[model samples]
Target: MGADYLKEMFGLEGQTAVVVGGAGVLGGALCRGLVQAGAKVIVADLMEEPCRKQVDELTQLGGQAAYVVVDVTSRESIESLLADSLKQSERIEILVNCAGVNAGNDFLDATDQDWDRIMAINLRAVFQACQVFGRHMIQAGGGKIVNIGSVTSHLPLSRVWAYSASKAAVLNLTRNVAQEFAEKGIRVNAICPGFFPAEQNRKVLTQERIDNIMHGTPMKRFGEPEELIGALLLLVSPIAGQFITGTHINVDGGFTAAWF
Candidate 1:
């Protein structure tokens, strides 16, 4: 809001950050935003093409960035990501866990494999990333962690039972990590976003789904990927968020506040 607020409170210059799932739309937006604020970013994704694309975009825009292929479902992949990250900057002072997915199956149609996959990617991935990179943060003396949740986790959404359940778990995971690591100087929190078209929801968000979302959202529009930058910066910047932890800031443009 003011120069002092930014100059004194929201500085992230020169910090090294790791953003899991940085290949997707929202994740790409976050990587660029962090770069603008002067944080060195590692764009970690499951695939190389999209991840490299993000790195190219950031480098073109004069930002410090790199790519790491990570399988959120595997412990070995997480370890490699952290290892490669250290090779680049030797520290992951800030991490944003965005490696999540939704199979979009109804509870009745959901199978065991579907359940396991969602849990591993959406919930356990965050747990693994935090535990691995979090150890680095702890050794270095402090850090920031932002886990991504979704509005559907709490909203009465249909045909995505496992996704909702996993996201809900993230809410508690954020708090628990915070409480356990606060004294050690790691701040963990989650961001529960409202409906926005992404890789997972594209198929379901047809014309009919658009009508439903716009009608339901108080803002009456889908959120742009850029809309999340400010809140992200606030949470990741220890200067601003040193006293904030075990909490979530909803950036849904009033999607949760309205029941009408």
Candidate 2:
């Protein structure tokens, strides 16, 4: 295929993308990918410093980008993010819900607080973000939303009971929302990632757990942060992903395919 043909299919020139949780590792990579694809990116997160830092990084890379402080736990806060995004870029063409939290605890030892906190950030926040962004997209005629799920979304893992349940809910919610807005020119989908160590998961990635994950994964290794960008670009591209929705892509290194 010609370079022009490929660009035509995936170019995001003049588009604006809002990446919630863009301050963190995986989210930061997604933000950079969006920028590289020619979209003006808004790096939204809970803290100003890190969000601004991401914007700086993108700027240094010669990409159009900015930052917005957001607290995804609140619907009003999410709405404010949408408002701020519009004010900065005129419109939002894509939304990536990457803000999430996890905890590792035995099933019997999982506390109500743990479950509530995990669900609040992982599931409820995605719901609120989708509703807020989905409404705007419907009114604007079209948009793309990519929610972050996990390997636990499909398979049960030792510990992380609340995290597993929350991610599972995220996957289901993605489908339901995708179907709900299919006729309205809005696409909702998910990316279920396997074991990729980051700040959020470091607390849980003990030696024993790492050994188990490697054994379960066919590739016998963890995924690189940048490895997720291709799938993300495909789902967010207006031309390439026009008909794709209500589905998920598992970037799990065959972990979901492996069984002992």
Task: Give a tens-digit lDDT track for model 2, residues 45-117.
Answer: 9999999899999999999998899988788899999998999887788999999988888889877889888
Instruction: Summarize candidate 1's per-residue lDDT along 41-120 as a digit string, tens digits.
Output: 99999999999999999999899999999998999999999999999996789999988887766678778998999899
- Model 1, position 220: C-alpha lDDT score: 93
**How far is 165's C-alpha from truth in model 2 (Å)?**
0.2
Off by over 4 Å in 2: none
Q: Kindly report which residue stretches of model 1 are placed more than 4 angstroms away from their true locations once superposed.
A: 1-5
TM-score of each: 0.96, 0.98
lDDT of 1 at 153: 52
For lDDT, the strongest prediction is: 2
